[model samples]
Target: MTTALLAIDVGGSTSRATLVDHAGNCLGQGRNRGGNPGSNPPDLANAAIVAAVEAAIADAALPGLTIELALLAMAGPKFKAVQDQLETALKALGLTGPVVFTGDLQAMVASVTAATNGYCIVCGTGAGAVRLRDNELDAVIDAAGWLLGDAGSGYWLGHQAARAVTADLEGRGEKTALTSAILGDMGIELNDDRLPDGRPVPYRHFVDTIYAMRPIELARFAPMVIANRTDPVAARLLAQAEDYLVQDFSMVFDRELAGPVVLGGGIVAHLSGLQSRISEIMRGAGQVPDIRLVQDGSVGAVVLALRSAKVTVDEAMVQSVITSIAAHGLRARA
Candidate 1:
């Protein structure tokens, strides 16, 4: 019997679905809007999940494919109400197999490293870190959401950038390039009497331009700040962001733990400066272990699925799956 694997990672602003064969070969990948019920409406979240799953199935074009394992890695609190509703939605999409729902930490721990015990940090649209012990989520440190946490997340940085630009515009803070960069990014002009589109201006008329954007969209300016990091204001912002990340990393990391410290999420994984700074800090704390950046998390979910299926998870096998799934996901996005 040919068994298939279904992996879904649901975040605050986006959800991705990937289907793979028992052999760890990529089948199809689908992406949809935010599906976290805690962030979006319950109905909207459920619809996003079904849409992504169905799209992935259609893309695979594998008729009669029966998924043996399905996992949903979700953000926010795993309320029972949300889980029941999500499971109902999955069942409606024809997934009736053994389904599991994991918190954001469990998913990242599995995806970022092969180690059964270690630490994994995610700093994407939101931020948080989780400690893995014996391959289970042991302790989580403050990567929750923007309302109460997520100090180093994209949403947080974007929000900070907005505040900086606004302060400068209002003459309450020093001027910086971020004002023009943010205005340009939003298609608004700084110091303009009014919005060209008649929409409220960013700072002068209102913060409507920034307010109109989703958290993920605002995070796009993170790179802009990076580009202008030479400016004192931008450099200060980056410094603050890095400090928050280091503190978060320190919080979940047990110095004596025996596992690699894996880094995921856009801010930490892709940014070399941030990665180096975080590494230096870790070394100072004597918590250094293998530090690796994960390519794609959907591939990690497949590894866990393979484990549940009683397949051998070794170095070579894990590498092969990662490579294949990474390529497949790239093709999917392209």
Candidate 2:
């Protein structure tokens, strides 16, 4: 009988679980929809977590494999409140060992390195930064949801783009490609409505369309902004986003800024243009930035689980786990 470790990473957009052995060999992987209780209802979050864990256990198909530990890196702020319920759920699935709960950022930073102290920045639908000391959160920067902050987040970029397009439509701002690009993507035509003077005033329609949905849905337009980055309006927004992100890193340090800065989230991880701009800006500030990008936090969850089980791990071991997960067709989203 082989003893296995169960590691789960719960994010706002997706939840993932992986089963691994002592040697970092991936036995199975499972995925489910967004499970962030902070962003989603508690019932939905718990269901997603349980479903992902169950799928991973079933996929392992190891008859005598006993899960010795289960570690969940969750995005919810009040995870401890539900830890007992989550543990009971895991136990129902045959987990015998203790279940541990950790912050999503902790798993994210650990995915790429063995260093226990550094910083982490997440720039997906929302943006935030954290300082980690001894693998625990020491300080935070700008994680204050969409209304309060999240300056460089996807929602921020999309909201800025929409505002610029509205300004352009109402003849209040400079004309740019974003006007047509955004309207086209949203299936809103300029002639969708008209003014009293019979002018093609699409701004009304656009405003109504935007205000009709949940604010977070604005992040869906972020890709359009990135796609039209060469446009002056889009370029300016992207630059501002880069500036905000770099500022986030700076504010978290509040001293000398340095490396092992692990970055996650769609904007920072997938946008090569923004990544280069950030590096260039950080260099200009006289800091050698060692920014590592992790697609999601699953691998870091695995690393944490292994360490908790008294298994020695290094960068090489992490890489091995990455490769093994890939070999098992458990690759993270690109």
Candidate 3:
């Protein structure tokens, strides 16, 4: 008969759902593959979301408990469509309550610093930063799609590596270990004008290739672009990425609010050095701000839901939530 709140974080590559009581103790949790309704086809994305939520509810084994509220954090630009799809999925699950749907960035911002007033820089499959001041969204920058933007993201990094290899082969750029590494990893010959057998290499192929490699492997090639930051041939590519983020934070400061900057997303979490470099560069421009990284955004979503619902966030409550989430054993399972 315990009423529980559900928090869901849907990223570009995966989704997670956690159930917690009024005390912030997580009761059960579930996870599945990515379900970005804005990016994926409507029907397919909705099905995936429903499946993940149902699996989590079942995993919790709280058969008869009623869900009091469901807070969803989903990635993508189309918030209304995502909300409608989520509501339909919830109805299909035979459970309903006060469901709140918001951007994945919002949950991410709340997660890192646990602050209602701050900014969040998310670098994952894509890259972007958002700021909230006094609980109101203030600024957002560089959230453009893969083709035009998303600097410092896995997709961007991988795409750049591939381009560099091609440039070197064409005698347009300096040779680097990334050329051979990319070829060996993808099992493709570097000299081939097109992908093996005259077919173009799929863009996603490069994305997966870079993501599948170890973090050290990717970082090895990422810094090469830093040296070329000013050359039109390479100058603005990497440095501009960092600059874009710095600009995003500057916008927040221009608003004259006192808040730290929270950095989240897989890319930022794994590449602390890159984030530090970006921060250092930003410091030289004046208005040096605090930066914190959030590895797991779901934890923040849970915290936000608890706070918004008027629940106290004490150290003991935080520990209880961690224990409950760990007891479910789903973090690694996903």
Candidate 4:
């Protein structure tokens, strides 16, 4: 009997779905824009998720095939709500199977660490860390939200950059290339008309401008802070972000868990310097955590789905699936 699995990873800005076989071999995948329910209205976010999953199944040419299992890794505390909506939606779409809901960090751990006893730290559009002990969720230091937290995340870096630019424009901070770069990117002239009182505008306006841009494009600016890390202002911001991540992970380490720390998400995949800095800080706290990056959570999602179906995932099988995934990329449908 041929068995298929559907795996979904829902994040703050987008949702992804993958179709895989019992042996961890990927068959198809799809993605769509959708923020976390904590950040967006539930109805709107759930609609986007349903669309993404349908598109993936259609792209896979697997219509009418019975899925053996379905796994979801959703962001935010409202995971159960999202899971319920997804299960009902999938059933309406004719997918009958065993469904499991969990945090996005958990899926990253399963994908990268390959052990139930490990941790996964995700720093992408937002930042958060989670640890597992004996295959159970043991601890977490959530980013909360961009307004209150998300330190060490792309949004946090971009937000800081915007603040710096505004400060320099207002003559409150030293001028840096970031000021010119940001204004140029936004196509906003710092003329008198644009600045009514001939004074620099509020920092929130600039932050809004950054947010208005596409996520990937906006996230690209995060590395600029790292690139200019030597500058006191930039260094201060980066250090603070790194510190938050260290604290988040340290809280879990304090519990005395025996597991390596696995890192995931867009920011972590792109920011080696930041990860190294956080690792150093963790060491100073008397915790030596082994860290590695999981470039794509879908890889782990497939593994999870397969395991749920009582399928074995050996290295050879994992490598075969990974090689296929690499060729197609997580965003590409198999």
Candidate 2 vs 3: which has more TM-score:
2
Clashes of each: 2, 0, 4, 0
lDDT of 3: 0.64
For all candidates in order, the CA lDDT equals 0.75, 0.80, 0.64, 0.71
Q: Write the per-residue lDDT of candidate 2 for residues 61-155, one digit (tens) a residue.
A: 88877788999886537656567777889888778899987877778788888887788888887788888887678888887767778898888
Best-matching candidate per lDDT: 2
TM-score of each: 0.87, 0.81, 0.74, 0.82
lDDT of 3 by residue, 103-146 (tens): 67777766655456777777766677787877667777776645
List the lowest-lDDT window of 10 residues for candidate 3: 214-223
The sequence of per-residue lDDT tens digits that candidate 1 reaches over residues 300-331 is 76777777777877767678788887788678
Higher-TM-score candidate among 1 and 3? Answer: 1
For model 3, state the Cα shift of residue 27 in Å. 1.8
Clashing pairs in 4: none
The lDDT, on a scale of 0 to 1, for candidate 4 is 0.71
Q: Could you give me the TM-score of model 2 versus the true structure?
A: 0.81
Give the per-residue lDDT of model 4 (tens digit) for 224-301.
776676777777777777677767876666435556678887767655465676567557667675777787777777
